[model samples]
Target: MDAMDVDYLNELLEQDVEIREKIKQQVSDLDKKVRVMVGILIKIHSTPTDTLPPLLDSVRPILRSCHDTSAALASLVPPNQFWRWKEMWSNSLRTAVYSAALVEYLSSGSLITLSQASEVLGIKEEWADRFSIAVEDYLHGLISLVNELSRLAVNAVTLGDYEAPLRISVFVKDIFAGFSMLNLKNDTLRRRFDSLKYDLKKIEEVVYDVSLRKLTDSTKSAVRK
Candidate 1:
């Protein structure tokens, strides 16, 4: 590796550290938030219909922002479908907690077993298999997107360009839009999608860090030689 590669490596280290900190902070906050929401749901369980809207309204954004952007960066790894965990929670704030777990997982570039997800969603063993399959399918598309985008990013950087994939973002936006429409029809499903959106973002951000580190190291090595 040359000086350029070294520089790039250093930059990536910094970026990785930064992302780790951000992920940690976000996870801590999300945990507290989920607990509060769960308490609220329990308090208003008898009148779930009334508590549901306010709960959804308050938690919607957290659900929206937890997307797995790293999947886009990597191409082969599908975006983990945090939303699909909704099968366990079934129309409460389960969407939000799932998103939180998902973001935490994506941020770490880890695989979440169906059992873990099922447990988090309070789902039983029999139904978890079906829901796990659905999550995997959804994750497949995300992984494809991430892998393709990663290829694009690698090629672009090699060619001396480094712009975020706005086109890919548009694609993600459109898909989410469809889900949004679906949300309007069924609140449970909608919240599930919302969780997915946020989880993907976290994934993408981590993938970006990985790429930048690779690039920075590559460049620094070249610079040194």
Candidate 2:
């Protein structure tokens, strides 16, 4: 990367921060509303699974009412950042947005259940199909980005390659830490976690939990005891 590239990363970071702030502002009043909605969703799902059409219908107004932020997000990144690393930043932005949303989504258990996500997202109907495709496409891109980023540790850098396992560990940790940026969605964020597993989601859960602990103190859990 050149000076321009460094500038690009900085610019992108600034944009992300700005967008994060905007989202924070947007969702400011949603706390109690979102909690109530989730409670109703849980009640509806507890007994008979309410068919998705009805459920999705119930949520549609809120989803549709969401203030479109494409313009604001666009405003965050400048011409220099967008012009040069458009594709990279786009993928990064999707990763950042979804991950930001995911942190909030997961913590509050507000995410459509995986089953519901599959149900609504899998419909062959034109409207839902496109939405599903977009999310899947972005998710695949995120997976690819992680793979590429992992290889960066092995990529030749200014001096030698990133030889230190400590550095690699730090890089991995930073990736998990970035999820905390989603706290901009809600100020009083709590650490969330699940059992450690090899799957990407599971691994992230572990890190999310650990990150919360580490934030309060320097000590943390170990992979092996």
Best by TM-score: 2
Local distance difference test, each candidate: 0.42, 0.36
Q: What tens digits encode model 2's per-residue C-alpha lDDT throughout 1-225?
A: 899999999998987787556545533433333444444434322222223345534654443322233333344444444343243233333333333233323233243332333232222223231122234334333333333333332332212322322233344445445543434332222212111112334334434544454521333333223
Count of clashing pairs, candidate 2: 0
Candidate 2 residue runs with Cα over 4 Å from true position:
1-23, 27-40, 50-52, 77-225
Clash statistics: count for each candidate = 46, 0
lDDT of 1 by residue, 1-225 (tens): 999999999998886576445544544554555565445433322332223355545544534432231111122212353342323322222334344343333234343444554444343444332222244334333333333333443344444443333333444455556545542444544454556566457446644764566545544576679
RMSD of 2: 19.0
- TM-score for every candidate vs. truth? 0.26, 0.26
